[model samples]
Target: MTEVTDFFRQGGGLSDTLPSFELRPGQIELVRAIEKSLSQHTHLVAEAGTGIGKTFSYLLPTLQHDKQVVISTATKHLQEQIFFKDLPLVEKALHKKVSACLLKGRGNYFCHYRYEMFLGSAFQLNKTQAKKVSRLQDWVQQTQSGDLSEIAAFVAEDYAFKKKITSTRENCLNSECPYFDDCFVQKVREKAKKSAVVVVNHSLLMADIVLKETGFAEILPETDVVVIDEAHHLPKIATQAFAEQVSSNQLLELGKDTLQVYRREAGDVEGFADCVEALIGAVDDLRDALADARPNGQVQLAKLKQFKRAYQAFQVLMQVFSEFLHALKALAERSSDLQKINERAEITAERIKSVFSPTAADDSHNDDTERQAAQSVAILEWHADYFKACRLPIHLGNRWQNVMQAYADSWLFVSATLSVGQSFDFFIDSLGLPADIATLQVNSPFNYAEQSVIHILPDLPAPNQHDFVPALVDAVLPILQKTKGRAFMLFTSYRNLYEAAELMQNSDFHLFIQGEHPKSQLIDAFMQSDNAVLLGTVSFWEGVDVAGEKLSCVIIDKIPFPSPGDPMIAEQSRYLESTGRSAFAHCYIPKAATLLKQGAGRLIRSNHDTGVLIFGDNRMLTKSYGRQLIEALPPARQVDSDALFTFIEDTL
Candidate 1:
């Protein structure tokens, strides 16, 4: 064992320093692998099961490394945990300190400039939203970092209130702003530049990649090593960052900003009011054209005739905007605000043109770099409440590697659910890592066979059947009764979640639904109440920790597969089929397996956590691929329904 592993042993530095330290062999092995990868300057994809204490495992090695390192996590919760909790523990264990800084996307930080402008702007607010704003007043003054996550009431459901207070890339004035000197984003990034280890979420990391590659000012410092904890989520985040998107919202926002700027600085510019009016009218026309369709999720742009006609009309309007923006360049010398407005207008016009073009995905950009970014095989999808045209990369592996390798020499991707059936092939192939990139799979230190029970309840309707939700709810009612409602009933879709929630409304348990409140508030309520049952969708599958008796059961309504109707998944399936690969094998099953593993993982969080994990779907017993997925998860003891009830009764 390496000295690092020895330090985690029973009488070692960590045990000597921290009273509650437990010797986890998996964590030690993970630490050794991370240390070796960092020292040798290589890449590693590791799957360390739950409760492995991976944050500390990677942090110990990263802290001791001579060169600067950046550690990115998938969630802000993990980002904050590593910076605020794990770093202190590791430093204490080693009896030495290393400087670390937490950096998040700019929107998370409070914007003094935006807040000032927001106060001056005459905005009509409802009592509810205004009450949320009032709640922020005290916390806003108390907070040092100004991260919005600290305020759970972000008005996420109310975009108008949020947009007024928060800063987005398009609206940011940067150094030109009056409050730029005391900017939270600036101060934190400057601190990160000097920090030995920088803590950031994947969104910020992806933003950094896009910024650096696009010849914009980059936020991250040059680092020798990069560790991505919760690496399973990175591929999706990267796909989004690398892809191109243009939306009605973008056009509308541009018009809004143009109108504001024109009134403030460019009133003398002729035809400005007409240009803004036309842009607004065109956006309204597009919205009205699709009013019947109300396109929500992923959709084929070509299939919608109205969408095409509206966009074609917008294309004509773009020419007018082009002329108007070009004219504004003559007035650009009037003020920096005018220059910025012109720049934003030009960029927005280009996005619309590129997205709306007949061969938008195929021959949109002339630059090789842009074309490389717009991968050869991609899905052109239209989505959302208003409208969005997006070109999503079908194969993101090679592109992800290129972006990541450009940033650092040694890279480590550590997550609890990176592997499927003891193999890292799914994850490695997804990220397009070379065959020789180091791979490791360490079992969680928790003895799942004793701590948990996995059950696929007998005789349930297939998820596709119309009666699935009711049947699933009926099957779980007894389990809920037996476990005393201290369970998380996770659903695949909001439809199913709502149906289940409706079915269980009359039950005695306190139900905490996902959308009824902020996610944090719902989880908090669930954890605090003994008879509470939290029903949630994708977000609850992972990143939830409830260690005590309050959460003694987890029930899943279906195999959490990527929806086939989802535009990205459909495109990926077609691309895989064309390449002579089974999309089910390459795309769907692996994605489902990782997600199922995450959901199942919510059950057995710590060594002391004993819970009943029930899968309401019978597919685990009948489907051909079910065994493979089952083997992929921790070795939870499979039990029949009667035995499961008995075990829960005995254990709890």
Candidate 2:
């Protein structure tokens, strides 16, 4: 194996390639450990702290391992960074050619057939949608990759336009389409099969695991090593993947597509249009029923009787869906397209039926644990104007472990926030990894004592108080003034963010609210302004890096605890109670600690960077769980508000 230590030494392998690269002992150690894990075919969990150059630490070793590897990250942005920026740099530094490919979800690619059909249709669209379609047409003719990210003018705000041009698994013609020879998704798969390193997001990786036996088995190539970055997010994402989800939007889309296919293939079919209309009507009735039952737009299925009309509406919707599938089957001989649509319709109907008519294994035939594993729970969630019924597994750990064991010979889970204090038990237990898995914690080389201060406002009231936002505004105004508006006031909820935004409306400082612009645009605007304050919520907490004087302070409104009312969290809490475990300590505290660490890590991006982190929740000092949160953070000096302001003033 190539020597990781030699690569980090002075005038080493990377020195001639990367002019400004500096040697970091922690990064070198992490690379060496990962290399060993890969060579030994053992599973490893590593926590590489901030400023450790973790991306390169893993990338370099994987490139030198001389085996196929799949690197899964938490987001598409990071996937692109590794494939385009980090991988190229590593290849240049090593003076070797390494085949690599970046693959995203199918929705990210443009379907040539769908684009053609969308253009040929006589559907009416508004001015903005029409303009977007026009732009997409011009780009489609010139682009080679056919990835949606290549279109500069296209934004996700136009969902209708996106749906019209992109193809889903249920709708894609695959080998039957006229443009199948030039299909972008198939081309991507072919490239991935030939590549040594494949960069993908967590969602794709999870999809590959869940759909391994299905037609989607080729989504991921065979690999010897699997490195999952941001591994803390794996358990939740995997749970969702293994769970069954049927949504009103899904039904509506199916109806719309069925109508489109009928029009194109067999427009004269009797009663077909009426069946589609009835299916759509049933979907709307159920959505309305759910809305009336829970005005807040979410309710657990166990407590669903409170919504008198939801059950009846769900039954009616399923009946109409079956009727539509029947009608499609009757027209199967009309065209191969109709036959394909009928097959997809039947699969969707079965999925909906399974969600509504849930069953558990018989107790006499199975053990208690097996019975519990077979149970399912339904959750109704609504966002915007769409509703979904998610049927989730009661237990996901054993299933996730089985999938992991089958997927790779060696596994490396790397993240900055994987451990709680000195223990990896919280993460390992959640993901069902073996107790004996290898572990490593590499602290950042930066000196936290000289670089950062954590400010605690112990006098503030609890976050639930009615005046908490007002008090928070009062507490943060002084810091913003001291720092001259180079701060990120990250709140746990949008209500707090909006209230703070209103408070700062007339201030001299330029305010950049989260929803006012895209995240990248907001960060750019913040960096360009001398005295700007960016107020945001959850997405701003992590994966955001602004190193110099552009961002000097981070103000968190509260320790981000999972909402007690969230259906998944409540379910997990119940499961823990049944197993005789402290859910608060086992589930809630560790989750919050990881998030708090991520938020605090936004400060001190480099050894030269200095900043103040403020917590206005008061729970960080008043609650007993505060100790765990404090222990999870970097070893920055804890100080009162006055001293914190003084330090910021002196440092700037």
State candidate 2's TM-score: 0.95
- Considering summed lDDT, which 10 consecutive residues are worst modelled in model 2? 357-366
Candidate 1 structure quality by residue, lDDT tens digits, 1-652: 2377777899987888778789888888888898888888898999888878888788777766565889999888788888888789888877788888889898778888777766655578668756776887777778888777776445556666666677878778889888888788888899899988899999899889999998768999999988898999888888777766776777777777767777788786677788778777876775655554456444554434445665565456556667666666777678888788788777776765544454332234457545543342323343444766665666765666677678898999989999888778878877777867899998888888888889998788889999988888888888888889999998889999999999889999999999999888898888888788999999999988888788888988888788887766776787778889999998888998888899888887777889988887788889899898788777989998778988988887
Candidate 1 wrongly placed segments (more than 4 Å): 123-159, 288-291, 306-333, 358-386
User: What local distance difference test score does each model get?
Assistant: 0.79, 0.83
Off by over 4 Å in 2: 123-134, 155-157, 291-296, 309-312, 359-375
Q: lDDT by residue for model 2 over 1-652, one digit each (tens)?
A: 5576688778877777788788898888898898888888888899999988888888888777686899999999999989898899888878889989999898999988888777777468778767877887788889888888887457476777777778887788889999999999999989998999999999999888777846555588889989999998888888778777888777888888778889889998778899999999999998888777665566665466566798678668767887888888899788888888888888787776555554221112336434533455668787546788777775665766676678888899999999999999999988878888999999988898888899888877789988888888887887788888889999999988998899889988999999989999999999999889999899999999999878889989998999988877787888888899998998999988999999888888888899899898788787788888999999999988678878987886
Error of 2 at 289 (Å): 4.0
- Please provide the root mean square deviation of candidate 1 (C-alpha atoms, Å): 3.5
